[model samples]
Target chain A: MSTDSAAGLLHDLAEYRARARRDRHGYWLPLLVFGVLILAAPLVYLPPSEWPPPRVQVSADGLFPGQIKVFGLTIEPLYMFGPGNGREIGNPMGVSWYWFGVVVLGLAGTVGWYRWRARRVGVETPTRLVVLAGSVGLLFLLGVVPLILGQALVLLFPGSYFYSNTAFWISVEVFVLAAAGTTVALWVRGGGPRPAWRVALASVGVVVALMSITIVFEAAFGHGHAPLLLLSVALLAVAAIERSAFCAVIAALFTAAALLANLYNMENVFYRFGFHVDYLNPRGEVFANLLLPAAVLIVGGGIAAWSARKASRRE
Target chain B: MSDHPTAGLDDVVHQKHRLAILTIAAEAKRVEFGYLQQNLDLTKGNLSRHITVLAEAGLLDVEKGYDGKRPKTWVRVTSAGRRALAEEIATLRALVARHENLS
Candidate 1:
């Protein structure tokens, strides 16, 4: 080939990589869908009467024994358990249940979306990574980490702290189920067994069904909600699958959103940047928790969508 | 070592389609056979020949599997393949620079 032909091949190589990335990573839809869902999540925390008086009743029982002072603001945590009722940042069981539904559904919906995309695009990206991360994280947080610490406390401190020894066995059982679920997922991907890869996969599907009913029950009614741990892990998995930097951003945003939602009033983080949500409503803090992550997802989705369009036009 | 950029071109990776395949495979963990076929604009048999040559040369790993009922094939570049592509691209860039200077 001529030198001109060689140079043209060099340019085409880049085009090919770009084309594969664009076609496989149709991640915008899920981002938009989950963004809307994230936006709607905190709506449940709205006070019964629009304007409740600014919280002033101090209580002795907080999630921890002390206040975290940040930027000269006594950062309000979502939960406080003292003898006197310490003010909760926003205590509504409804918010917890909503996130419970959103997370379980979001992860499940993502798997389903990939399956449907496989039918159309004819390229299968294993979604088991996402499910595996979510399940493992779920079992680890509610079971292993707490169980280990709980056991350590009981062993070292004795009567001072009471850890549940009975739950350890249950946690081990759920891990086995998760392992089987993963094997089935791999078997499906590996083209094992003669009659459709997942006649073998369904045998494994039953394991997943079992896990869905395990320690996750606690996540359903966690004090406020199981921090968007499920969503965060799932997003990270997709980031790896697509090799999309934008998806990684969405994952990081969700993780930060989850942590802030759990420990500190999200409004306080915004307060540090001179953006106060108090003027928005008496329940500004609740909106603060959900709003930032929501904006990130929607805006991130739009950016991804725009890039996809631009890529297609150029192609 | 040679004075000319042509001396740097890797024989296996210098071909147009093979270079494209390595570049695409390097962009993701692995790529579907159909994706390579479509993007390369080659017939299944033609693509198979190139893939076979690359695989035999230890430049790519071919995985035959299924996505549901449909048969699927995945192709990924080996570490040696990545090194080869990088070396080939660097040489091609040098050749292009030479052309630009001569023009």
Candidate 2:
């Protein structure tokens, strides 16, 4: 075949593939949901007003020491439930609990939305892959990443780690590292030569990033802000799943906002404008984190909706 | 085992319409019959015949199911089909490079 003909064929195939991928995307629904969820997060972080979102009470009545002795089992295998570590971090309502619910709902909502949209639009994205990406990312960021970073903190400043059990944590770190190393080795074995170097580069980069994030945030925001970074990672996973450059940009911006909120006292920005953040009400990092990421998602959803429609018309 | 890339051209997957079908189907987990038929601008019978040919060659898995009361035909590319498609693309890329070099 002639070069022009060959090139033309490739182009045609690529166009079909792009069209297929694009037709399947309903990312705007999830982006909007994510934005609203982020906006609602500060409420969970702050003291409630006259009316509050009803808190689901889990009674510790079932009696436990890392096990539901009544049932002789626990549903949560990764995190065995333990009783009474009732150390409060600012709010009465748990922000971590809020995030946990939101992340689960968000992933679940993604699957439901795609299935619903498929019934309407005739084509649907592979929701299984998207949900899988979100779940894996959720586990990595919420569970694994903090432990790894905690180990780094222990190494960098001895006796400075947040959790006190040094020996247990060391063993946990060793096991986690071995698991991660084996997984990396498996990926790199058949993935050509440079991947080993890339893995090393990535390891160094992650360590440097963890240290920098900790150092930067520790002075301004102080403790419990690490988990706040989890929100942006979910956006990133969806972006990767959809292969949407637009969603990826929004995710990056959200990550920056989350980092900024974590490090800098956002009330200072408000204070410069002669608007003091009322101590009684939600303010400061709460507002800063909420507005930027929500704006990114809510605005991004609008753009995605428009783009999807435009692409549909073009097709 | 000819050295020429043309020798690698897959007879089953080489035609333009079938290649387009594979390309589209390969993008998603599974593709609906109506969507493919509409996208490729093919008659129901024509597309069915093509699907049958690919299914017979073990390149496509055809499932007839109910989406409600309505019957839907779904097509998925098998592992062999993915390998075939990848080989076809590589061969095409090689063919283009060879042509470009001669020019």
Candidate 3:
């Protein structure tokens, strides 16, 4: 090629790079939707019974213990045992809904973080179709199926062993195992340069990890079961906004950390509730809980690092 | 001579605008028409004509679709297109190198 053509090519190349660099648009819409979601979820989730109880009347003398007023609304504190123990227990439903809202907000936060990272890396922002399909599929697989199967198993056994506890364990095992399996699969297959079944599996793995963590954490906190709807929205939002497998990996890491904490705490909580499983022993539980999630994170991170190195080498 | 650096340059692929389109498409994997036009500072008619030329030459693939309500177009470099771009870039680099040597 002539020197002029060579110079022109270099100039065009520079222009292309400059344009891509200037294509930086913030993810404001996703952020707005996330805010609306966080606010709206509690409204939809709170049952009428959970609405703040009819305003309690404080004695005009103000000598009553635990009597407080805020915004002219009299408040009575609930005490397990005290002179002013007239406080009614707040509806558990309300508490559950509140945490559920937090969980959804947490998911939104994760997506926002990933979306910003995606702009830097040039990961394609996921399309609406991808988001819808991924969220719906995860809900069907991890939520609906588990509940139905758990109920059916309870009915079939009619034993205390097979009741709520059995169903809960079964669901956890399925979700965690699926997440680990998918992560390992993706790690082995390597999601690079093209979309493959491994890509789909990686998505499944991330969704299942999120679900498993939500369930385990809710159970640990004695919070109300977070509705699957919140999880579906979280998955949809994250899937829609994030295009990198790294986001999925980050999500998996978050879930794994939660799982480790929950597992350690589960022994004490479940033991107190008169539930004893073999792995409750300090050493055994350590082996049981730490093995899968920890291994998944370690192995997945290693594989991803290696794959990136390999790709860079190829380039 | 057949060994001349310009011998490797493909006429249909080496045009500056098409080279820009190919480079963007190669980097993005799939690039929208509006993106190319905006980036290259070309009018719609001009971009459309250049894209048609590249597509007819089998240097890239043009896909027509809708982005929500608005009509949209995307261009992607095919395997042939990628090879052509790579070869063109290599030749340009060689030409630059030869000129640098002479200077």
Candidate 4:
């Protein structure tokens, strides 16, 4: 080859290398972290005896009766089951399977959607592995923190878990609100269509109104309010349809509200549907703590995967 | 052939450094000045000049605050900046497609 051609080849090689570095560095690292966490979920459930038991004490005078202590805070136990006579009754493995299934399904759906969209667009979209990683990290900070705190509260001060410690719920709500708001702001400012402030304000107003209405209906119908649960489920479904960070926020808010309402009334719609809230009890706190957050993470993860696949197909 | 389809593709933002800065800023909700400098591998002076150009173009908003007593500078892409960056990318892609097809 002539000297000019040789130099030209070298230049092209350099450009390729530069592109590789840029794309690889930004995209792959976070994805690897996410993958590791997903793979580690099953391993998290060791034998129950290896797990610490819920610390519960009945008062001598029956004055502070049936209180459970967790994380240095004292709260009444939500249920009065007989203390463990060494027969491990609860199914941590089943609970893990349910959560894992939700996450996997959600991720698959998201990945599938993205791949389809990318193919249709006929442009290579950026790798969303990094974005997925960031989302997972955000989930840990926002979703996981509140959940752990909520579980701790339930274990420690069972009586006050539902009502008196409004701060915990409020903190969770704030995190969810901020995450949703930041995402909307970023999306809008990132060149997506700008939604009107009035629309947002109206949506908030409507959510509050609906929640209040549900509460009233629940009061009238007692704990078995199918309509209220249906409403909650519908809202969650709508949030998923919206397919933005705001949707995740809305889903989280609705889930939190539903959980609180259930706890307050000592009723579990999730349980009626064969989902367990017994895990929320002191003995099963870790499973309770991990389950819902993991569900939300998986949902978000699925969306990220879908978005990535869409981007790749476009490319 | 032009090295880049985006090469000399003039808009309000065809400048290379400015494009890089905007891209970085757009990805982050907020990014520190030093982080931008390190990522772009630009000198402090070079980064500052490009940042100024972007700020003037209304594509970025630069804020200087104190993290304790030390001064901290952060950059964020404005809505206008995001639009410009998106337009730039689309234009670049189109140019590349056109050139590739012709070749």
Candidate 2, A108-144: lDDT as tens digits: 8888887777655556566665666666766654444
DockQ for candidate 3, please give it.
0.22
lDDT at B18, model 2: 88
Q: Candidate 4 regions off by >4 Å?
A: A1-315, B1-8
Candidate 2 chain A: 10-residue stretch with minimal lDDT: A75-84
True contacts kept of 4: 0.00
lDDT of 3 by residue, A141-187 (tens): 33443443334344444565433565467657967787888767666
2 versus 3: better lDDT goes to: 2
Task: Name the candidate, 2 or 3, with the larger TM-score value.
Answer: 2
lDDT of each: 0.66, 0.67, 0.53, 0.46
Clashes of each: 8, 0, 0, 22
lDDT of 1 by residue, A1-315 (tens): 467976887788877776667777878877888889878765555554663535444455332223334444343232211111222434343444455567667778888887777556645566678889877765654454334332333443356222233443454465577667656565545444546544566656654434433333332223343446566777888888887887887778877866666555667778998887755443466567667777878898888889878977896
Higher-ranked by DockQ: 1 or 3: 1
Q: How far is candidate 2 from the true structure (C-alpha RMSD, Å)?
A: 7.7
Tell me which of candidates 2 and 4 scores higher on DockQ: 2
How does model 4 fare in lDDT?
Answer: 0.46
Lowest summed lDDT across 10 adjacent residues in model 1 chain A is found at A78-87
Docking quality level of the chain pair in candidate 4 = incorrect
Best by lDDT: 2
